[model samples]
Target: MTAPGTDAPSTSAQDDVLFTGVVVYSTQDPEASAVLVSGGMVAWIGPTETAEGLHPGARRIDATGCLLTPGFVDCLPTADGAAVDDAWRASAASRGITGAVPGSAGIREGMRVLSPVAEPLPLKDLSAQGVPLAFGSLGAEDALDPWSWVRAAAHGGDPAQRISDRAAFLASTRAGLRLLDVPHPGALNLGVEATLVVWEPWDFTVHSSDIRTNAWSVDPRSRTPMLPDLTEGAPRALRTLVRGEIVHDVPGALG
Candidate 1:
């Protein structure tokens, strides 16, 4: 029988990737310290030393002295200019944002939409280009509703799987940010797609950005690296992954 409060019941050795030497933040553990990924989903999570024995064949990536978390999921208000699609994606990837739900009024290149389009071709094109499709009604016109949307979705789910407000509003790249009644909006659980991000811890010696905003200190909302309102100055994204693929990676981020 599986022991209570332990993830051994779901552990498996077929994972494709293993991340070690970093602190993993998830709905299951605030700092799990290690994560195992397989087939674009998180297979298991626990201590770093124990991970190797679980998946010996997995590709090990060292994240020494860094903070590991889910990649950011941007809400509405992305630019619709096709000419700047690459630039927009680069900027978002640099900031640890792996997916986005653009405003309905504009057609932003490479954006994932909350609601499905009437035409199947457009949806297929986006998916072919690596965009995730989900359902919802979050529009740019309804700006004030997002605050409540963020709160309800992040904190109102199963206690163990309830995602941090930061992760739900900032690091959830799976689309479907338009409703308030969904279950576990952004919880990081086993068998879920491995969309992840890494951030370098700030030491007194390193030259880190000091872009402090009101959101950081606020109780339910910490100004994580990937909030849409955060225009300038924040911790670096370091690395990002979508469906276990390296969507963005900077020098020294893997280590």
Candidate 2:
């Protein structure tokens, strides 16, 4: 797809693009540090050491000190009556949002999108009951940052009812994709569309709901991929790619 706000030609799907030195957040391979996108699909994911050798002539993007994850899907409406045009899509892509189900579309599809308003819903309880919960901005006029919704869901409401950071992140990403029946449902596995975001480096930790547990859940034994520490504030998106094509890129982010 053509990048928003740019008349420049789009990247050809036949071209190979390799991103190295990134912390890839993939459930299928949590330790992956590099990714190869070929023909608009995820061709490979593994350690950085093997990337260059496997794809010798691929265009390389040095993503050192960055975290790469599936692009977020917005489950809320944009500014009231805002046209879903290139400008709007460009703004959302800058914030790592790749897709959306705005306004009545979400409700019509039976997707539960909770607004970040006073008197929060019982997120943890609803999540425990297999109720798929997705959090969004307070209103149409609110900023279109998915991280804010994640933070609200993870830390708002009754202390006992707050969801874990990981859960909230998934709700903002994979859950929305699944609800919309998007192919592969937000995963970065081989052959899947390479729609993702590269984020500025940030501290990360595994979150736990248990009060007795240590504040930082860094045990490798858990085998859980680490997520950005919301306590330290949200990380900025350096680049956003849709189907292996650059949609938004911050200057000097690839260096």
RMSD (Cα, Å) for all candidates, in order, is 14.2, 3.1
Off by over 4 Å in 2: 1-10, 78-82, 105-110, 117-119, 138-140, 211-217
Worst 10 residues of 2 by lDDT: 102-111
Q: How far is 254's C-alpha from truth in model 2 (Å)?
A: 1.1
Provide the global lDDT of candidate 1 against the true structure: 0.49
Clash count list over all predictions: 2, 0
Q: Write the per-residue lDDT of candidate 2 for residues 125-214, one digit (tens) a residue.
A: 877887776655534455367887777777666788887777788878886677667756445777778888889988866776665553
* Tens-digit per-residue lDDT, 1-255, candidate 1: 111322222323234777787655555654466778887788888888788998789778787666665665454443463423655555666666655554552233333444221212243244346654442223333322233333333333333333334533432443433322223336456666676676665321111122243334333233123222222323566666666766566654453
Error of 1 at 248 (Å): 0.8
- Write down the TM-score for model 2: 0.87
Against the true structure, what is each candidate's TM-score?
A: 0.52, 0.87
The lDDT leader among the candidates is 2
